[model samples]
Target: MLDKAELGKRIKKVRESKHLTLKNIEAAAGISATHISEIERGKTSPTLGALMKISKALGKDPAHFIEEVELNDVSLVTLEDRIVEKLGSAGTMENLTTSIPGGKLQARFIRLSPGKTLDEHPHTHYGNEAALVLSGKILFTVDGEKYETSQGDAVYYNGLEEHSYENISKKDDATMLWVSTERGVS
Candidate 1:
């Protein structure tokens, strides 16, 4: 579940980093300055609509504000502690790393059953993505080019392009580690 207070803090941090004042956001997002201030102070939570408007005004994705990452010298994610979510109907994705405050990268471990596919048609995002096949085989398609990768193989590409993946093995499940970094952000 998402934490509202943490989300508010993250929004405040991003707003400050962008040098955006409450009044500026109010003018751009059509939200009241007092309401924005209350949200920043963690006294109130914004609705999805308000969050979208605030994100647009701040020139960021709404996820940038809602993602909760702990700041620590060393963070550990065990298999048992990983958060898993269904990916379409043929695969599952485990978030390998928690979002880091002010950080630009995210990582995930994806598993697909044999003959299953994960397709992202005409996808575009402001970042770069890299994947390493950990087991079995995978067919990765990027910008109309297809590359077959087996265990120990890896692929890297600009994320602002169409891409998709498939578990190409007949009987084995495929696993891969995916890492992506935000574009225009260090």
Candidate 2:
């Protein structure tokens, strides 16, 4: 069971959060607006290929959109459980959602430890990014502009700027949730 209902909810939320209309998704995913409507309504199920194409058009991961939620503990994301197996590894991310389930936004949950810095790959995804620091502290570098983040703080920046995160704290762990979406990124 793909949990089309839950997926539909996430899809709807993403669409609304991005301020995108059915026609926008239809244009991006090549899935018909009517079909997308049905999917959002949980009236129809999408095929894997259709789902993948839709995700690509919307700038998200097909896998993240289809995650099964635990009825026992709604806050317990199974994705997080998977990441716990390799807890201490820097750059380990427990994907919170397919980030931008459909449209122009994407989100991820990352855990970083002291002295570990993530990669500096240059990426030009089509959006801006907001990273919410949930715990500990991190040193963030966006196209050479450096900023430090701590619990209760968030960093927002342009997606066009190359960026990476580093755990500069020696005594604590860093947890961050990243949400990104935009009109365009150059």
Candidate 3:
């Protein structure tokens, strides 16, 4: 059965994940905030037209709200289809996890070029972060403190601390599997 409340919840989750409010949806969808509130609260069901408008406002497809999804034990991402992005002079990063609706964790494979840092400066965010060195050596700095790590070494820390890593190897790239809890849509 298609539950109106569950549909509303899904819509609300996506909107919140995107850091949007009812008023934001209102302006983008051309629907009243009060009406959207009613829809989100499951006090009423939105018409297909209104749902379409809301989905568009949230940058989601209408089916995302209404489709029935079977609970799956695993999600897969193939090598060929992996999302890859260059980090400028820092090297490259490859997404290791498939994007799933309401997923909480994200993993990535980071290849840090020799003498390059993961970011130009230290960064901080909410949640937890951990990494396992796959190759070469890295200098991991957190909150002004430094730790030297080599292949097979693992590190975990609170993401609230300012942290960054650099490939200490002068002639080779350093690789690591980085994992963190997702704060929201990035």
Candidate 4:
């Protein structure tokens, strides 16, 4: 069952914790800012599709907002408990951060299949992102500039840029440790 007010509060808390404005979510999720505002205020509920988009825009799973969890001073997510999501033909993403209140940093282990990209096109969101190549080769395109990276190489940039990456090797997969900070409007 869905609790609309609780859902709204969770969404609002996560959004604010990530330093995101309604407009930021709108740009990433393709939902209207007004509608997001209403949802955050508990004046309305988001549809399943809307929720999925909103969750993705927040770099989270929809369950992250809906699941009821207690907050603690120290949070730990064991390897066994970590959540993993498939990126279709691209490969997989394993979230490495604990789901604690006021969390602002997101860490993920991304595996990119050979010659595959995480997204079809370059995308932008607020905040800053950094990645360290752990295996194989990656070709990163940031704001139209191309950067070829190998194992041990690191890349850092503002998330607002049009950024995307692809596994450059046709015979091997590429892996990276990616960390990103949530953004807020001034």
Top candidate, metric TM-score: 3
The window of 10 residues in a row where model 1 has the poorest summed lDDT is 66-75
lDDT of 3 by residue, 52-163 (tens): 8998899766766776772232678789888789999899999888655446688999999998998778888888889999999999999999999999999999888888
List the global CA lDDT of all models.
Answer: 0.84, 0.73, 0.86, 0.88
Model 2 steric clash pairs: 58-103, 99-106, 99-107, 100-105, 100-106
Ranking by TM-score: 3, 4, 1, 2
Report the C-alpha lDDT of model 4 over 1-186, residue by residue, as the tens digit. Answer: 448788888889889989999999999999999999999888999999999999889877786666666344356778898788999999999988875645778899999999999978998889999999999999999999999999999999998899999999999999999999986532
lDDT of 1: 0.84
* Candidate 4: residue 142 lDDT (0-100): 99
What are the RMSDs of all candidates, in order? 9.1, 10.2, 11.2, 12.3
* Global Cα lDDT for candidate 4: 0.88
TM-score of every prediction relative to native: 0.59, 0.50, 0.62, 0.61
Q: How would the candidate models be sorted by lDDT, starting from the highest?
A: 4, 3, 1, 2
Q: Residue 1: error of model 3 in Å?
A: 17
Q: Give the residue spans of candidate 4 off by over 4 A.
A: 1-69, 183-186
How displaced is residue 1 in candidate 4, in Å? 19
Residue 137 Cα positional deviation in candidate 2, in Å, after optimal superposition: 1.1
- Candidate 2: regions farther than 4 A off: 1-88, 99-101, 120-124, 182-186
Residue by residue across 1-186, what tens digits does model 1's lDDT show? 357777778778889988989999999999999999889888889999999999899877776676554454235789899888998777899988764445677788999988988764546577999999999999998888999999999999998777788999879899999999985422
